[model samples]
Target: MKTAYEILDVSEQASDNEIKQAYLQKVKQYPPDHHHNLFQQIHGAYQTIKDQKSRLNYELFDYPEADFNILLDQALVSSEALTLSADSFDKLLRASIDDSIFQFSTTHKINNT
Candidate 1:
Protein backbone atom coordinates (compact mmCIF):
# COMPACT_ATOMS: atom_id res chain seq x y z
CA MET A 1 0.00 0.00 0.00
CA LYS A 2 1.28 3.43 -0.91
CA THR A 3 1.43 6.11 1.74
CA ALA A 4 0.09 9.56 0.91
CA TYR A 5 3.63 10.83 0.55
CA GLU A 6 4.51 7.95 -1.76
CA ILE A 7 1.33 8.40 -3.82
CA LEU A 8 2.10 12.09 -4.27
CA ASP A 9 5.83 11.44 -4.85
CA VAL A 10 6.89 13.87 -2.14
CA SER A 11 9.13 13.60 0.92
CA GLU A 12 7.75 13.72 4.45
CA GLN A 13 9.69 16.96 4.96
CA ALA A 14 8.19 18.63 1.89
CA SER A 15 6.74 22.08 2.50
CA ASP A 16 3.07 22.86 1.98
CA ASN A 17 3.82 24.55 -1.33
CA GLU A 18 5.82 21.55 -2.49
CA ILE A 19 3.01 19.20 -1.51
CA LYS A 20 0.50 21.37 -3.33
CA GLN A 21 2.64 21.47 -6.44
CA ALA A 22 3.02 17.71 -6.40
CA TYR A 23 -0.73 17.31 -5.97
CA LEU A 24 -1.40 19.64 -8.89
CA GLN A 25 1.00 17.72 -11.09
CA LYS A 26 -0.67 14.46 -10.11
CA VAL A 27 -4.12 15.84 -10.88
CA LYS A 28 -2.97 16.96 -14.27
CA GLN A 29 -1.55 13.55 -14.98
CA TYR A 30 -4.65 11.73 -13.75
CA PRO A 31 -7.58 14.06 -14.21
CA PRO A 32 -10.95 12.90 -12.86
CA ASP A 33 -12.62 12.69 -16.25
CA HIS A 34 -10.12 10.31 -17.77
CA HIS A 35 -8.86 8.38 -14.71
CA HIS A 36 -11.52 8.27 -12.05
CA ASN A 37 -9.94 5.78 -9.63
CA LEU A 38 -6.43 7.17 -9.96
CA PHE A 39 -7.77 10.71 -9.63
CA GLN A 40 -9.72 9.70 -6.51
CA GLN A 41 -6.60 8.14 -5.01
CA ILE A 42 -4.56 11.23 -5.79
CA HIS A 43 -7.24 13.54 -4.43
CA GLY A 44 -7.59 11.44 -1.27
CA ALA A 45 -3.84 11.43 -0.78
CA TYR A 46 -3.75 15.20 -1.24
CA GLN A 47 -6.52 15.69 1.31
CA THR A 48 -4.62 13.49 3.81
CA ILE A 49 -1.34 15.48 3.91
CA LYS A 50 -2.03 18.78 2.21
CA ASP A 51 -1.08 20.96 5.17
CA GLN A 52 0.81 20.81 8.47
CA LYS A 53 -2.17 20.08 10.71
CA SER A 54 -3.68 17.52 8.36
CA ARG A 55 -0.29 15.90 7.88
CA LEU A 56 0.24 15.69 11.63
CA ASN A 57 -3.20 14.19 12.11
CA TYR A 58 -2.61 11.70 9.34
CA GLU A 59 0.73 10.67 10.83
CA LEU A 60 -0.82 10.26 14.25
CA PHE A 61 -3.82 8.19 13.19
CA ASP A 62 -3.13 6.54 9.86
CA TYR A 63 -2.50 2.77 9.98
CA PRO A 64 -0.95 1.19 6.93
CA GLU A 65 -2.81 -1.57 5.18
CA ALA A 66 -1.43 -5.00 5.97
CA ASP A 67 -1.86 -8.55 4.78
CA PHE A 68 -1.95 -10.83 7.78
CA ASN A 69 -1.24 -13.99 5.77
CA ILE A 70 1.90 -12.51 4.26
CA LEU A 71 3.06 -11.26 7.65
CA LEU A 72 2.50 -14.69 9.21
CA ASP A 73 4.33 -16.36 6.34
CA GLN A 74 7.32 -14.05 6.75
CA ALA A 75 7.38 -14.53 10.52
CA LEU A 76 7.23 -18.31 10.16
CA VAL A 77 10.01 -18.31 7.58
CA SER A 78 12.27 -16.13 9.73
CA SER A 79 11.55 -18.03 12.95
CA GLU A 80 12.97 -21.24 11.47
CA ALA A 81 16.45 -19.65 11.03
CA LEU A 82 16.51 -17.70 14.32
CA THR A 83 17.08 -19.36 17.69
CA LEU A 84 17.83 -17.77 21.08
CA SER A 85 19.74 -19.57 23.83
CA ALA A 86 18.15 -19.49 27.30
CA ASP A 87 21.08 -17.56 28.81
CA SER A 88 21.06 -14.98 26.04
CA PHE A 89 17.32 -14.45 26.40
CA ASP A 90 17.66 -14.09 30.15
CA LYS A 91 20.44 -11.50 29.75
CA LEU A 92 18.39 -9.58 27.24
CA LEU A 93 15.40 -9.50 29.57
CA ARG A 94 17.51 -8.31 32.50
CA ALA A 95 19.15 -5.61 30.39
CA SER A 96 15.80 -4.38 29.14
CA ILE A 97 14.42 -4.23 32.70
CA ASP A 98 17.48 -2.39 33.98
CA ASP A 99 17.27 0.14 31.18
CA SER A 100 13.58 0.72 31.85
CA ILE A 101 14.26 1.23 35.55
CA PHE A 102 17.10 3.65 34.82
CA GLN A 103 14.95 5.64 32.45
CA PHE A 104 12.11 5.79 34.95
CA SER A 105 14.41 6.93 37.74
CA THR A 106 15.94 9.61 35.55
CA THR A 107 12.56 10.86 34.44
CA HIS A 108 11.23 10.86 38.00
CA LYS A 109 14.24 12.80 39.25
CA ILE A 110 13.93 15.37 36.49
CA ASN A 111 10.21 15.81 37.17
CA ASN A 112 10.71 16.19 40.90
CA THR A 113 13.77 18.38 40.74
Candidate 2:
Protein backbone atom coordinates (compact mmCIF):
# COMPACT_ATOMS: atom_id res chain seq x y z
CA MET A 1 0.00 0.00 0.00
CA LYS A 2 2.98 2.29 -0.11
CA THR A 3 2.74 5.23 -2.48
CA ALA A 4 5.30 5.80 -5.23
CA TYR A 5 6.35 9.03 -3.58
CA GLU A 6 7.27 7.20 -0.37
CA ILE A 7 9.06 4.43 -2.24
CA LEU A 8 11.16 6.89 -4.28
CA ASP A 9 12.38 8.83 -1.24
CA VAL A 10 10.78 11.97 -2.63
CA SER A 11 8.16 14.31 -1.28
CA GLU A 12 4.66 14.53 -2.67
CA GLN A 13 5.39 18.07 -3.85
CA ALA A 14 8.43 16.95 -5.82
CA SER A 15 8.42 18.02 -9.47
CA ASP A 16 8.69 15.54 -12.33
CA ASN A 17 12.37 16.35 -12.89
CA GLU A 18 13.10 16.12 -9.20
CA ILE A 19 11.53 12.69 -9.02
CA LYS A 20 13.64 11.48 -11.91
CA GLN A 21 16.77 12.89 -10.35
CA ALA A 22 16.07 11.21 -7.04
CA TYR A 23 15.45 7.85 -8.71
CA LEU A 24 18.68 8.00 -10.68
CA GLN A 25 20.62 8.99 -7.60
CA LYS A 26 19.17 6.12 -5.58
CA VAL A 27 19.94 3.60 -8.31
CA LYS A 28 23.58 4.65 -8.40
CA GLN A 29 23.89 4.21 -4.65
CA TYR A 30 22.51 0.68 -4.82
CA PRO A 31 24.76 -2.38 -5.33
CA PRO A 32 24.29 -3.18 -9.00
CA ASP A 33 26.67 -6.03 -9.89
CA HIS A 34 24.01 -8.65 -9.24
CA HIS A 35 20.22 -8.66 -9.63
CA HIS A 36 19.98 -5.83 -7.10
CA ASN A 37 16.43 -6.42 -5.93
CA LEU A 38 16.24 -3.09 -4.13
CA PHE A 39 17.30 -1.21 -7.22
CA GLN A 40 14.69 -3.00 -9.28
CA GLN A 41 11.99 -2.05 -6.77
CA ILE A 42 13.09 1.55 -6.86
CA HIS A 43 13.17 1.55 -10.63
CA GLY A 44 9.77 -0.06 -10.86
CA ALA A 45 8.31 2.57 -8.55
CA TYR A 46 9.87 5.28 -10.66
CA GLN A 47 8.57 3.77 -13.88
CA THR A 48 5.09 3.48 -12.44
CA ILE A 49 4.88 7.12 -11.47
CA LYS A 50 6.85 8.69 -14.32
CA ASP A 51 4.16 8.39 -16.97
CA GLN A 52 0.99 10.50 -16.61
CA LYS A 53 -1.37 7.63 -17.35
CA SER A 54 0.56 5.29 -15.09
CA ARG A 55 0.56 7.93 -12.38
CA LEU A 56 -3.19 8.17 -12.67
CA ASN A 57 -3.44 4.41 -12.43
CA TYR A 58 -1.30 4.41 -9.31
CA GLU A 59 -3.27 7.18 -7.66
CA LEU A 60 -6.48 5.39 -8.46
CA PHE A 61 -5.09 2.14 -7.02
CA ASP A 62 -5.85 0.36 -10.26
CA TYR A 63 -4.25 -3.03 -10.73
CA PRO A 64 -3.81 -5.17 -13.83
CA GLU A 65 -5.97 -8.26 -14.13
CA ALA A 66 -4.58 -11.52 -12.81
CA ASP A 67 -5.87 -15.05 -13.15
CA PHE A 68 -5.23 -17.22 -10.12
CA ASN A 69 -4.41 -20.68 -11.34
CA ILE A 70 -2.46 -23.03 -9.11
CA LEU A 71 -2.67 -26.69 -9.91
CA LEU A 72 -2.69 -29.06 -6.95
CA ASP A 73 -1.50 -32.49 -7.92
CA GLN A 74 -3.41 -35.43 -6.52
CA ALA A 75 -0.19 -37.19 -5.65
CA LEU A 76 0.84 -34.30 -3.45
CA VAL A 77 -2.26 -34.69 -1.29
CA SER A 78 -2.80 -37.31 1.36
CA SER A 79 -4.91 -40.28 0.36
CA GLU A 80 -7.44 -39.53 3.08
CA ALA A 81 -8.03 -36.00 1.82
CA LEU A 82 -11.11 -35.15 -0.20
CA THR A 83 -10.81 -34.99 -3.97
CA LEU A 84 -11.11 -31.79 -5.98
CA SER A 85 -14.56 -31.37 -7.46
CA ALA A 86 -14.99 -31.16 -11.23
CA ASP A 87 -16.24 -27.54 -11.07
CA SER A 88 -13.25 -26.43 -9.00
CA PHE A 89 -10.88 -28.25 -11.32
CA ASP A 90 -12.39 -26.52 -14.34
CA LYS A 91 -11.97 -23.12 -12.72
CA LEU A 92 -8.38 -23.87 -11.84
CA LEU A 93 -7.67 -25.02 -15.39
CA ARG A 94 -9.05 -21.82 -16.83
CA ALA A 95 -6.98 -19.73 -14.48
CA SER A 96 -3.89 -21.76 -15.37
CA ILE A 97 -4.46 -21.12 -19.07
CA ASP A 98 -4.93 -17.42 -18.53
CA ASP A 99 -1.77 -17.18 -16.40
CA SER A 100 0.24 -19.16 -18.93
CA ILE A 101 -0.86 -16.96 -21.81
CA PHE A 102 -0.06 -13.81 -19.93
CA GLN A 103 3.41 -15.02 -18.96
CA PHE A 104 4.21 -16.34 -22.45
CA SER A 105 3.14 -13.14 -24.18
CA THR A 106 5.12 -10.96 -21.83
CA THR A 107 8.27 -13.05 -22.12
CA HIS A 108 7.96 -13.28 -25.90
CA LYS A 109 7.60 -9.54 -26.25
CA ILE A 110 10.64 -8.86 -24.08
CA ASN A 111 12.78 -11.41 -25.90
CA ASN A 112 11.71 -10.15 -29.31
CA THR A 113 12.43 -6.59 -28.34
Candidate 3:
Protein backbone atom coordinates (compact mmCIF):
# COMPACT_ATOMS: atom_id res chain seq x y z
CA MET A 1 0.00 0.00 0.00
CA LYS A 2 3.02 2.26 -0.02
CA THR A 3 2.93 5.04 -2.61
CA ALA A 4 5.88 6.16 -4.75
CA TYR A 5 6.16 9.21 -2.49
CA GLU A 6 6.61 6.91 0.49
CA ILE A 7 9.25 4.86 -1.33
CA LEU A 8 11.17 7.98 -2.31
CA ASP A 9 10.72 9.45 1.19
CA VAL A 10 9.08 12.49 -0.40
CA SER A 11 5.84 14.12 0.61
CA GLU A 12 2.73 13.49 -1.49
CA GLN A 13 2.67 17.19 -2.39
CA ALA A 14 6.37 17.28 -3.22
CA SER A 15 7.39 19.10 -6.37
CA ASP A 16 9.01 17.22 -9.30
CA ASN A 17 12.42 18.63 -8.36
CA GLU A 18 11.96 17.53 -4.76
CA ILE A 19 11.07 13.98 -5.84
CA LYS A 20 14.10 13.88 -8.14
CA GLN A 21 16.38 15.08 -5.36
CA ALA A 22 15.08 12.42 -2.97
CA TYR A 23 15.34 9.71 -5.61
CA LEU A 24 18.94 10.69 -6.42
CA GLN A 25 19.90 10.65 -2.75
CA LYS A 26 18.42 7.19 -2.30
CA VAL A 27 20.13 5.92 -5.44
CA LYS A 28 23.49 7.27 -4.26
CA GLN A 29 23.03 5.38 -0.98
CA TYR A 30 22.14 2.19 -2.86
CA PRO A 31 24.09 2.29 -6.10
CA PRO A 32 23.25 -0.34 -8.71
CA ASP A 33 26.84 -1.62 -8.64
CA HIS A 34 26.59 -2.48 -4.94
CA HIS A 35 22.95 -2.71 -3.86
CA HIS A 36 21.17 -3.88 -7.00
CA ASN A 37 17.90 -4.78 -5.24
CA LEU A 38 17.50 -1.48 -3.43
CA PHE A 39 18.66 0.43 -6.49
CA GLN A 40 15.92 -1.21 -8.60
CA GLN A 41 13.29 -0.23 -6.02
CA ILE A 42 14.46 3.35 -5.91
CA HIS A 43 14.70 3.51 -9.68
CA GLY A 44 11.21 2.08 -10.10
CA ALA A 45 9.77 4.46 -7.52
CA TYR A 46 11.43 7.36 -9.30
CA GLN A 47 10.00 6.20 -12.63
CA THR A 48 6.48 5.99 -11.18
CA ILE A 49 6.54 9.63 -10.10
CA LYS A 50 9.25 11.17 -12.28
CA ASP A 51 6.82 13.62 -13.93
CA GLN A 52 3.65 15.45 -12.93
CA LYS A 53 1.62 13.62 -15.58
CA SER A 54 2.76 10.19 -14.38
CA ARG A 55 2.04 11.12 -10.77
CA LEU A 56 -1.44 12.34 -11.67
CA ASN A 57 -2.16 9.16 -13.67
CA TYR A 58 -0.97 6.95 -10.83
CA GLU A 59 -3.01 8.90 -8.25
CA LEU A 60 -6.16 8.85 -10.36
CA PHE A 61 -6.28 5.06 -10.71
CA ASP A 62 -6.72 4.09 -7.07
CA TYR A 63 -8.22 0.63 -6.79
CA PRO A 64 -10.82 -0.06 -4.08
CA GLU A 65 -9.58 -1.86 -0.96
CA ALA A 66 -11.44 -5.05 -1.91
CA ASP A 67 -10.07 -4.97 -5.45
CA PHE A 68 -6.57 -4.31 -4.19
CA ASN A 69 -6.85 -7.28 -1.83
CA ILE A 70 -8.09 -9.48 -4.66
CA LEU A 71 -5.16 -8.43 -6.83
CA LEU A 72 -2.69 -9.12 -4.01
CA ASP A 73 -4.23 -12.56 -3.41
CA GLN A 74 -3.96 -13.41 -7.08
CA ALA A 75 -0.35 -12.18 -7.20
CA LEU A 76 0.60 -14.32 -4.20
CA VAL A 77 -0.29 -17.55 -5.99
CA SER A 78 2.65 -19.40 -7.57
CA SER A 79 2.74 -19.30 -11.37
CA GLU A 80 4.01 -22.89 -11.38
CA ALA A 81 0.76 -24.03 -9.74
CA LEU A 82 -1.33 -22.66 -12.62
CA THR A 83 -2.23 -24.64 -15.74
CA LEU A 84 -2.09 -22.99 -19.17
CA SER A 85 -5.05 -23.29 -21.45
CA ALA A 86 -4.74 -24.27 -25.13
CA ASP A 87 -5.36 -20.65 -26.15
CA SER A 88 -2.55 -19.47 -23.87
CA PHE A 89 -0.21 -22.08 -25.29
CA ASP A 90 -0.98 -20.87 -28.80
CA LYS A 91 -0.38 -17.26 -27.77
CA LEU A 92 2.99 -18.17 -26.23
CA LEU A 93 4.03 -19.98 -29.38
CA ARG A 94 3.06 -16.99 -31.48
CA ALA A 95 4.91 -14.61 -29.18
CA SER A 96 8.08 -16.68 -29.34
CA ILE A 97 7.91 -16.77 -33.15
CA ASP A 98 7.33 -13.05 -33.31
CA ASP A 99 10.23 -12.33 -30.95
CA SER A 100 12.57 -14.50 -33.02
CA ILE A 101 11.53 -12.79 -36.24
CA PHE A 102 11.93 -9.34 -34.69
CA GLN A 103 15.39 -10.16 -33.39
CA PHE A 104 16.49 -11.52 -36.74
CA SER A 105 15.14 -8.51 -38.59
CA THR A 106 16.83 -6.08 -36.23
CA THR A 107 20.13 -7.89 -36.57
CA HIS A 108 19.83 -7.91 -40.33
CA LYS A 109 19.01 -4.21 -40.38
CA ILE A 110 22.00 -3.41 -38.21
CA ASN A 111 24.31 -5.42 -40.43
CA ASN A 112 23.03 -3.60 -43.52
CA THR A 113 23.43 -0.23 -41.85
State which candidate has the highest lDDT: 1
For candidate 2, write residues 51-109 as lDDT tens digits.
43345344434333311111123211322226667776555444434456556777999
Clashes of each: 0, 0, 0
The lowest-lDDT stretch of 10 consecutive residues in candidate 1 is: 66-75
Kindly report which residue pairs in candidate 1 clash with one another.
none
Candidate 2, residue 1: how far the Cα is off, in Å: 5.4
Clashing pairs in 3: none
lDDT of 1: 0.70
Candidate with top TM-score is: 1
TM-score of each: 0.55, 0.48, 0.53
Best-to-worst order by lDDT is 1, 3, 2
Model 3 bad stretches (over 4 Å): 62-113
lDDT tens readout by residue for model 1, 49-104: 88654664465347344233443343334335256566764554344344565567
Cα shift from native, residue 61, model 3 (Å):
1.8
Error of 2 at 68 (Å): 30
Tens-digit lDDT track for model 3 on 1-113?
A: 66677789987657779989999899888889999987888898898778644554354353122233332232234223267666764554344344565567779999999
